[model samples]
Target: MNGAQSLIKTLANCGVDMCFANPGTSEMHFVAALDSVPEMRAVLCLFEGVVTGAADGYGRVAGKPAATLLHLGPGLANGLANLHNARRANTPIVNIVGDHATYHLQYDALLTSDIVGFARPVSAWICESKSAQTVAGDAARAVQAARSAPGGVATLILPADTAWNEAERPAQMLRDIGPAPVSSQAVDDIARLLGNGKKTTFLLRGSALHGAGLEAAGRVQAKTGARLLCDTFAPHSEVGAGRVPVERIPYFAEQIVDFLKGIEQIVLVGAKPPVSFFAYPGKPSWCAPQDCQFSHLAHPHEDAAGALAALADALNAPAQSSIRVPLQLGGLPKGPLNAMSAGQIIAELTPDDAIFAEEAATSGMPLLVTLSTARPHTHLPLTGGSIGQGLPLAVGAALAAPERKVICPHGDGGAAYTMQALWSMAREELDITVVIYANRSYAILNIELQRVGATGAGAKALSMLDLHNPEMNWVKIAEGLGVEASRATTCEEFASQYAAAMQQKGPRLIEVMI
Candidate 1:
């Protein structure tokens, strides 16, 4: 068998069934091999950013790595932004980047560039296959690396010659490894801290913000009178009725400091100490209070859920100590569609078991706060602080869990970064409802300009932040991309359009003029 076939077989055997690809000439052989291996489902993405971001979404939902096929260094560069997001999210992904033939590297062809150098910053593990006989083993190891503790991105650079050459046999599939156990001493220490009666909080992320970890944390909170807070940008979190509610740290440093004001101790669970997204002129970078003592209960690589459960036992938490949020849908607003009205409409209409991918920037914060107590759903945010992740992430999440409806609330400025994802959604017939907040400007940047101490009244600077020379017709754009869409100018219009979209199947878009 050819090396490409061997690699595909190895990936399928190791539980990687889906591949997001935007291929070029160097990857033709690997593309052709997809037909030979019927088990590997190949998903075509128009842009490399969509390819990488979709893989990130799939990993968050599937709890396994999805492969991404890019052309070469340039193509890998095209996908690097979302790869940065994936790295920060600690999502499992196997990047298969194609390179020129081994012998052709000496000539430095037009597409030839430093592939390894570009991959090092975003990848936790990287390997270049030297020969066809070694490609299968390399691919197997790449999967192993991606599925390591807390998951990570593993890049495998494949030369053309190695892909086309014959291999002796397919490599054996590697076994999946579990996360490391949390230390008993660490759990006991956290228990003692909680027993001291000082004001304390549990800062959560990764697995500790959802599922069993969240339940254990709720028990700890009920028993110890401590608060529960999640990171500002969590990769994935399950929320809504019957689940424990977690307050997210505010994005602004000033607001975060206020939120954490009284806390005397912080027990981190798969999260870092609160810090500002950027250094402001007069604000402190660290958001925690000056007297707050930090303690690590569980690292990201350790078993966070297990650690939380053990801590609950140590605290002597009661069996029914978990706090459950009751269903509380807000009433629909009756005026023009501003942030508040829009948030109310969404909270009233969002379906149960939906997957919400948010990139609404400043406009969506109010909506997120409203939906915190809405129906049960899974929330996926932009973990890497990158824009243009919402739509593509919705695509991947829908693909991963076909039974669950995916809802993406995107900002107008950020939506332009990866709009090609709409076409993919239409082609795949995915159940996704995209709500674009058509403010016609980079609202977040405008807020940042003020935060960074930039003075007002400059024509050029204001022009750069505005998107209104000609307003973007999102309805026309969505129709052009083969997806049904509508424009909503008022609260009633938005509620009607959103309800209609949810009732229908396949992909749809609603442009809310706020």
Candidate 2:
């Protein structure tokens, strides 16, 4: 078999059956190999960023790596911002980037750049196949690296000569690397801390926020009177009214400092040490109290659920009764819009089992409290803090759980980053209700300007952050991309449109003019 065929078969063997791609001339042979292999489904993207970001979203919801095929360095560069976000979110992705042939590189082509240098910041593992015989081996390794730990991006650069050349049979199966076990000593330390009855909180994220892990945490919290908080920007949070009710650490440093004021100890479970996302001039980077003792009950790679379960037993906490969920629709807003907002829509229109992909930027802050009342729903925030992740994430979530309604509450500025996802939603018939907050400017950047003390800026300086030039008409944009669209000017209209969109089959877009 040719090297490209071997690589394709290897990825399929590893259970990565879907690929998002934007190819160029250098990838012709790989494209040809893909054509012959009907088992692998390649979804086309107009831009490389869409391809990479879609793969990132797929991994976030699917819990496995998805492949991305891009033209060499320039293409990878175009996708780097989203890749950076993927790296931060730790979503597993296998990037197959096509490069110039060995002989062609000596001629100094315009497309050439330092591919490895560009990939290092985003990829946990990166390699370029030296020969056809090694392509399959590299592909297998890339998959393994991507699937490791909390999941990560792995890039494999392929030269044109290697793609058309003969290679050995592809790896038929992947090695299973189970989640890491928690350290016995760490558990023992945390148990002692909880015994002291001092003011303490258990901070959890990633897998610790869901399933058996969260149940274990609830039991522990119920028995011990310890508080539980999730990281502010977690990729997926298994939350809502009845499901443990974790308080997220405040995004602002001052608020966090106030929250942690008298806390004696902080235990982390599958989460990093709590800190501000950005630094304020006079504030300390770390938000926890200076005297607070820090401990990790379970690291990200460790089996958080197992760790929590074992810790609960060690602490002798009783298993709590199953929580109850109310199966009713919340009341809708009335009258004209008048800044009734995205938070209001989420609180009023969120159906049971709704999945929310929130990339609403600053407009999302109010949603934290209002939607906290919405029971039995899953909320996924932009883990990597990348702007364009929402729509694609909604697509992936809809595809992942077809029975559940996926709601994407997005800011118009951020939505523009990967708006092409609307086309994919239409093509794939994903059950996603995309609600765009049409403020028509990067409102978050305006906040950032003041937060960073950029006051009294000139017109041209301020104009760069505003998007009112043509004032993006999201309704038209969604329709142009083949998705059915509507506009809602008030909270009542938004709630009505959102409910209608949620009940309907296939993709729909709601432009909520906030």
Go through the candidates in order and give each one's C-alpha lDDT.
0.91, 0.83
Candidate 1: worst-modelled 10 consecutive residues by lDDT: 169-178
Q: Which stretches of candidate 2 lie over 4 Å from their true place?
A: 321-330, 338-341
Shift in Å, residue 436, candidate 2? 0.7
Against the true structure, what is each candidate's TM-score?
0.98, 0.95
Pairs with steric clashes in candidate 2: 337-490
The residue-by-residue lDDT of candidate 2 on 311-425, one tens digit each, is 8888888877244233333466666663335576667667777888888787788776667767578888887766888887787677667788888888899999889989888
Which regions of candidate 1 fall more than 4 Å away from where they truly are?
none
Task: Report the number of clashing residue pairs per model.
Answer: 0, 1
> Candidate 2, 82: how far from true, in Å?
1.1
- Candidate 1 is scored at a TM of 0.98
Cα lDDT for residue 276, model 1? 97
RMSD of each: 1.0, 1.9
Total backbone collisions, model 2: 1
How far does residue 167 in candidate 2 sit from its true spot (Å)?
Answer: 1.6
**Model 2, TM vs. native:** 0.95
